[model samples]
Target: MAGPGQRGVGEPPRLLKIVMAGESCVGKTSIVRSYTDPHGAPTSSSYLTTIGIDFKVKPVMFDDIRVKLQIWDTAGQERFHTLSTSYFRGAQGFVLVYDITNLDSFQGITSWMKDIHEKAGDEVDIILLGNKCDKESERVVPKQKGEKLAWEHGIPFFETSAKDNVNIEDAFSVLTKEILEKKSCVLYDFDVVALNESKKRTCCAF
Candidate 1:
């Protein structure tokens, strides 16, 4: 991962805007910090809730491409919901985080997903993240339940611990790959049309 203000030369890296959404105190901010600055020390578990939104940008290499992710960590409180939901606009993907230790947090994914789609559109890519896996004893949301929810909705899923740094990169990587794939499809269609146009012009010239 490239540090802040650091980027590779050549073509400009594609910017991918992503949002972290879930119930309050689900470690959304921690996940953003971890993924953007993996070398930094892990965030303490007792951090206060986000007020409105936190933002970060990190450059990552995937295959031959470098993508700069614009991550928005939105507040999960009900009062901030309106303000947070506005940030969902133009986001290419979302990380719906929930704490495994809190059953209410896990159950809140349904409503979060609903709001995300309402603002960002249904085609936006999403991943179910069960956070705080390090506290195994406190885990109330079983892995199966999370997996089932993911499967039922056909979205990718992973268990992550912001403190332990578990599956955090995998979750982001999966979402980025989906974004890149969609971009590739659109570019390929343009190329096909361009090729057809060239063929028609050459035939007319002959």
Candidate 2:
């Protein structure tokens, strides 16, 4: 893991935008803070609702390639739900977070996912995150419930505790790898076409 603001000097790091979405007070902002905070500060479990939107960046290195993750945290209120659609534009990935103790929040994931695909298109990558997993005593949604929902939507699911710093890094790492693989595939296709064009030009010159 690269430290915050740490990157190579040669080429500009490729920026990938990811949006955090779910019902209000599902620890979306906490998750973002936990991931981007370099000093490993403890995130508070208290519910703090996001008003509108805020974003932060974390510089990361994967296989010697520097990448910057531009993570956007959005308000999850019903009024702001429609507002999230606007920010969905150009987002490469979405982390749908729900509190494990709140079954209603978990139920809200489907609605959020619909808005995501409606605004960001079907090709955008999504991951289902069951937050506050450390609260086992108060858990309303079971582990298999989250897994079943994720499977139904064909997206990866993770149980994370932002306050406890559990699975936060692992979940983000998996999402980053998925996005990078898609980007690498696109670049590879472009290179193949460019190489073929060069061959045609060379044959014509001869």
Best by TM-score: 1
lDDT, model 1, position 72? 92
lDDT by residue for model 1 (95-160), tens: 999999999999889999899889999888999999999989998999999999999999999999
Off by over 4 Å in 1: 1-9, 184-206
TM-score of 1: 0.83
Give per-residue lDDT, candidate 2, residue 199: 98
Instruction: Please give the lDDT score at residue 191 for candidate 1.
Output: 53
Residue 55 CA displacement from its true place in model 2, Å: 0.2
Lowest lDDT sum, 10 consecutive residues, model 1, at: 1-10
